[model samples]
Every structure is written in structure tokens, then in C-alpha cells.
Target: MKKYRITVNGKTYEVEVEEITAPAPAPKKETPSVSTIEAPKAKAEPAPTPAATPKKATPAGKLTINAPMPGTILSIKAKPGSAVKKGQVIMILEAMKMENEILAPQDGKILSIEVTEGSSVNTGDILAVME
Candidate 1:
């Protein structure tokens, strides 16, 4: 048996508890927890204003390629400083039980690769950048 004193939110409480912790009763095996909180439903916060969208880069400028759909990145076929051709396969993305080849949007050098193999990505996740 033990006694405990707790303070939270500028309030104090004294509690007495018995410590006869044997194998927890079957179908009620969860450890008992002590709290001074009142459970309540969560309230959603207001959405924030969206920032302005950046202009998409052209072949002469750095172009970022985002995931066309949500999926795991199976492989990144190119790295930074690698030359790529228009419509060249730059990455392989796996989504919905399919392995889809990602093609370069334009002829350019790979400027950056944003995701690694086996990493999960969502639609619009920046996958690579070319310039």
C-alpha cells in the first residue's frame, strides 16, 4: 500500500491506494491509471489561410516533380547532377499494387531528389527536382 500526493494546474490532491497488484484479472488486464482530468470530445481548430502557390519552373529553370498519387517510392533511378531526357524514367513508384514508372517532365539535369526508396509518399509529395 502507498500514498501519493499530486499537483497539477495549481491544484493539489492526496490519494491513498492499495498495492495488491497480482496477475491482472482475466478480461480486465489493463493497468489502472489515476488522473484528475475530465475526458471530453476534441474540438477541431479553424483552418489556416493557404499560402500563395509558387510558379512551376520551366526547362530553363529548376522544375520540381511531385508524386502523381499516394504511394511508396520503390526506387529513385536518378540522383542530383544526373542528365535526364524528356520522358525518361526517373523514378519507380508503387501504388495500388502497381509499379508505375515516373518520367521526366522535360530534358534537364537532376537538381535534387526529395524521397528515398521504400519511403511512403502522398499525392503532391515532392519527389524530384530538375534543372
Candidate 2:
């Protein structure tokens, strides 16, 4: 076992790790002959149709806010049609156990929010649109 101290976000944590060793190989066992049994055939089924989900339309010539990293949305601080200032926190995203603030790029009115709380998003994924 090995012990180590780690620091993250100005916090320190002590942890212990256990090392594992490979075990010896097991002896081979005899298998049943293929000719002894006959397998039944399976019938193919059609794939189920997905439910329709309504999508919000984005206006043209609007600024889009995108996620900077892959994470789950923790909370939304602003709503659609709300006015926001530059550098204002619009939402919070939880990534790698860290809460990252999603800020507005510029002063504008939010046209729409693309993601809800608890939704997962990846880098470059659109989070909202503003005018």
C-alpha cells in the first residue's frame, strides 16, 4: 500500500492506494462438443420508434453560448427573454466535481436556453442563444 497527499482547489486530501499483483494462470478445462446440442433460432424484431421532442427555434444573427467542457448542468440562473449583462453568470455546470460558472458573453436578452438542469453537455455544445 502507498500513501499520498493531494491538493485540489486549495484543499488537501490524504489517500492510500493498494497495489495488486497478477495471479497464476488456471489450467484449461474440457468443453462439450458442438454436435451434442442444437441451438434454437431467434426472430428479429423491429426497432421501436422514438417519441417526438419539441425543439426551440433560434433566431438568426444571434449570439450562442456554448459549453466549455463536458459536464452536467447544475442549475440555471437566468431564463429566456431575460436581460443579462456581460460577465454575468447564466448557469452552473458540474464537471470533474467542480462547479463552473457559465457566463454571458455580452450584454443581451436571452432568446432561449437549450439545456435544463441535470442535462449533460459536451464542449462546443450550444447552451443558449441571445440577441
Candidate 3:
């Protein structure tokens, strides 16, 4: 075993590590609370990952309403393919201990409701599309 001392912010600690020979492969373990996300497969093979450069996202619709800040979706007041009026409440986004109504910015059919109640969203995340 080898011992080493570490100091951080005026604190010190000792650690020991031992060398092992011919180590066996460790068993793979899965946690009960961990979920494995599988991506869509193409023709029985794994899809290739995208390039390092982020693809420019297609510009969202002109009349789409986006999240104002990071928050939880407290409620959804509209559905997909429904007609909505300008300034109508589409969802209640909760942030900073207050519920902010996410309203529509234009009169159009609700192309999609991107989030459901209890969803966590961030600033500039698309919440709904109108077209």
C-alpha cells in the first residue's frame, strides 16, 4: 500500500491505495432507480451520433410561445391542434415561488403542446407552437 497526503483550503487528509495484480472484471450493476434511455434504431443498427458542431435548430414558428425562465409546468390549459386566441393562457409556469401564465402571442391553431403538467422547462425552451 502507498500513502499520500492531500491538502485543500487549509485542510489535510491521508489516503492509501494498494496495488492488485490480475484483477478480474467487475460485475455490471444496475441501480433500481436508474433508467436506461434507448435511442431510436435505424434498420436494426444503432443510429450514428451527430457531429460535434451543434446543428442549427430549425427556426421555430414565428408565433410560438417560449418559456420565460427555468421553471416547472404547473398546468396546461390548451391541447394540440386546438385553436387559440392571442393572449390566451396556454400554461402556468411556476418559477421563483410564483405562477406565471404562459400566454399565446398570436391567434392560430395550436400545432403542438410541447410540455405537460409537472414538466421542468428552461428559459427559451419552446412550450407551444402556433401556426
Candidate 4:
């Protein structure tokens, strides 16, 4: 056996380590006859619980345009008072180091611009409005 003392942060402690020997191996038991044992029957699994129905997301209004995901506004392609068609690119959002185009969802004149260039927005945040 060996003993040692250690000090840490003004506290001292003594530790002793004894030499270890390998343990003797255990003896193996004889296997039982397979015919003497009956096979176990499978248990039936419980039925899965039903999930809750999700509520529909109702937009505040048809004219409100919201961000689809969290990101920074890279550029605004159209400004207020500008006429736009459905599927037209309205702005660029930088998210996850990639540029994503924000599109005009319907044909209308932009009523207001809610976010400025280089501004950060989260999912469902209003970015623009049209009517």
C-alpha cells in the first residue's frame, strides 16, 4: 500500500492505494433442457393515445404580411404605395446564412412597410401590409 497527501485551496487530504489482485473466475452452470421450459408468450402492446387537434392559424387580417421564420431583413424590393402582383418578390430575408425571398402573397398595392432594411424579425412578425 502507498499513501499520499494532497492540498487544494488550503484543504489537505490523505489517500491510500492498495495493490489489487485479479479475482478467480466463476464456474459456469450447466444449461437446462429446452423441452423442460415453455416459450414465453408475447405481450400485447397498449394502443397509442390520440393526439390533440391543432388550431388553425388565423391571420390578423388578409393584408398583414408576416415573416415565415426568424431572420434579418436583407433588402426591401418594394416600398409602400407600390403595386405588386401575387408571387412577386417583395423583400429578401437573411436567415441561417442564406438569402430567402419574401414574396407578395396577393395582388395589391403595398399599404405600409413595417420593417426596415437590416432589421431583425421573428416568425409571425409583421413585415408589410397590403390592400
Supply the TM-score for candidate 1: 0.55
TM-score for each of the candidates? 0.55, 0.56, 0.54, 0.54
Question: Best candidate per lDDT, number?
Answer: 2
The alpha-carbon RMSD values of the candidates against the true structure, listed in the order shown, are: 17.9, 8.9, 15.5, 18.5
Better of 1 and 4 by lDDT: 4
lDDT of 3 by residue, 1-131 (tens): 99999998999999999988987999869656878999887677688985553222435554667789999999999999889898899999999999999888888888777788999987878788778
Give the winner by lDDT: 1 or 3: 1
| TM-score-better candidate, 2 vs 3 | 2
Give every collision pair in model 4. none
Considering only N, C-alpha and C atoms within 3 Å, which residue pairs clash in candidate 1? none
| Weakest 10 consecutive residues of candidate 1 by summed lDDT | 52-61
lDDT (C-alpha, whole model) for all candidates: 0.87, 0.91, 0.83, 0.88
* Candidate 4 segments whose C-alpha is farther than 4 A from its true place: 1-62
- Pick the winner on TM-score between candidates 1 and 3: 1
Q: What digit string (tens of lDDT, one per residue) describes model 4 on residues 1-131?
A: 99999998999999999988989789769876665677899899998986643423434654888899999999999989999999999999999999999999999999888899999988878888888
* Cand. 2 Cα-lDDT: 0.91
